[model samples]
Target: MTERIWKIGTRGSLLAMTQTRMVQELLAEIGVRSEAVILHTRGDQLKDKPLWKFGGKAVFVTEFEEKILSGEIDMAVHSAKDMPAKTPEGLVIGACLPRENPADVLVVRRGNDFFGGGGKEKRGEKKADPASGPRIGTSSLRREMQLREQFGLENVSPLRGNVPTRLEKLRTGQYDGVILAAAGLARLELDHEPDLVYHSMDAARYLPAAGQGIIAVECRKGGATEALLRHLNDRRTEVELAAERGFMYGIAAGCHEPVAAHAVLGEDGTLRMRVMKYGNGRCRYFSGEAPESRCALLAEELAGQVLAALRPAEEEEDHRTGSRRKDG
Candidate 1:
């Protein structure tokens, strides 16, 4: 019997909607008919303001979560990258699509050689890979640290906006090249992908943002869709994301602090987690693994490190926000 329709919920942003469409297509492969219910989130409206100034990272996916609780929607789709280290109770990630390319790329002006992104050495800085000098733009402190401090790039600035806006700015030569997630460019069909020539940095060298390149299908706990989701769930991805989010939670990374982590599942079912935290006097790396476990525990262990990083900065924050962070 053909299922008539499953109401899928997602944020109104282009990236969120794009991921939703991809999920719907995946459902079609399994003979499920689904509909997307576009929900407005505060993150979509407050484009001008930074996320921390608002309700922190909680504001990003909270509305869709509300919809799921209210029974107005059966499932919600999310970009694995934007998902925070923690999710609310009574909801579980039902499915996560096969991850896209998970590297970050440098997008430069019409004629810049920051990694020779657009055809090998145009601006004459081609003497050698100088390891330093040139401007970089990104919204992640994690990216900044990896690109600037680690790689020796001198100029790093914050670049914020939807995908199109960021690309347009790059095309006009406003920045030497901004750091963008490779997966997003491929999804949007852009030509300058990360693998093309942009220093091909590994996630180990640059711990990815928490939940990067992972899309999740979340449903109410013990719902009718439980079995369906388990069938769709990618255990390998679940393991990877779980480990990464766990590290983030450990570090207590919310909108307040810029942190990054990435996890990978090996051929033999081994899971490895890498985390980076740069705040106050701490700039450190942590790595660990679990042979067998659920996603929850993986996230918990990663969050443990994050918790350690924030111990010193605790006095500067409000109690309400600090307590309810990743650990909360």
Candidate 2:
């Protein structure tokens, strides 16, 4: 006798479907049966408005989660970056897969995948670079501000849609280049195609959007999915993601706030954190190291210091803007 095939709920996007398919294949290899149940989420419907306008980080996960609570789906699969630091009611994130590059990359039109590598995009090879002539598109204010503040590139701005859509925009010259998760391009198997060129960034020089390349497996709290996910969980990724998200969540980072953080395991196995915050046409950074075992505490402390450092100036600017609004 075989167990019933479990159905996993996910957003109905190409990358979402691809990732869910991978999970199903992984389960099949273990002799467990599973299927993908696609759902259209509110965040999926409104691509033009920056996410922060409507609840920030949790917007993408809210609809699917409602179904999980209703028993319409047994589980939900999400990009770890989109999940909030605090668990939603009656739900738990049961697994964090081993992370991919977790670094952001700059992508150009499909014609540039191999300018320097003999047309072979290696494990770390990029699909494009941020050359001066190409107009780069990035959906994140965090990416845009940093690219300008730190990289001196003046053309980057917000562009919406999933991986393929963004790539199409780039291909059509809506942008000479765009920024996307390096992990996303690889996960969808579009990384090595000969027609595209992209540049993966150095994390030390560029702090990545929080939890950029990890996936979160969510299920009803204390449910069977929890028991199953425990098997697929990667312990180190779990700790690192938790700490990075802890920092972002601590500062109450919303889509509009423009924040980024990346936690990496040092050679000594401790967690080293890099954080970024953007406001009023300026960007600032924070860094720290802690024992991986004490990640949560360290993340909280660092988040406070970063925010405190920026808040005073931000508030004064806010006050000035409010005064102008009143005068108008």
Flag regions of model 2 displaced more than 4 Å.
110-133, 318-328
Q: Per-residue lDDT for 144-240 in model 1, tens only?
A: 7666555556467667787778877766666667788877777777746443334445777766777777888888888577677776788788777
TM-score of 1: 0.82
Please write out the lDDT profile of model 2 over residues 203-321, one tens digit for every residue. 77778878888888889989687888778888888888889889987998776667888898876988988888886567778889999778998899988998789889889998999
Q: Deviation in angstroms for 302 in model 2? A: 0.6
The window of 10 residues in a row where model 1 has the poorest summed lDDT is 119-128
Assess every candidate by TM-score: 0.82, 0.87
Model 1 C-alpha RMSD vs. true structure (Å) is 6.4
> Which sections of candidate 1 miss by over 4 Å?
1-3, 116-133, 193-199, 280-282, 294-328
Evaluate all candidate structures by whole-model CA lDDT and list the values in order: 0.72, 0.79
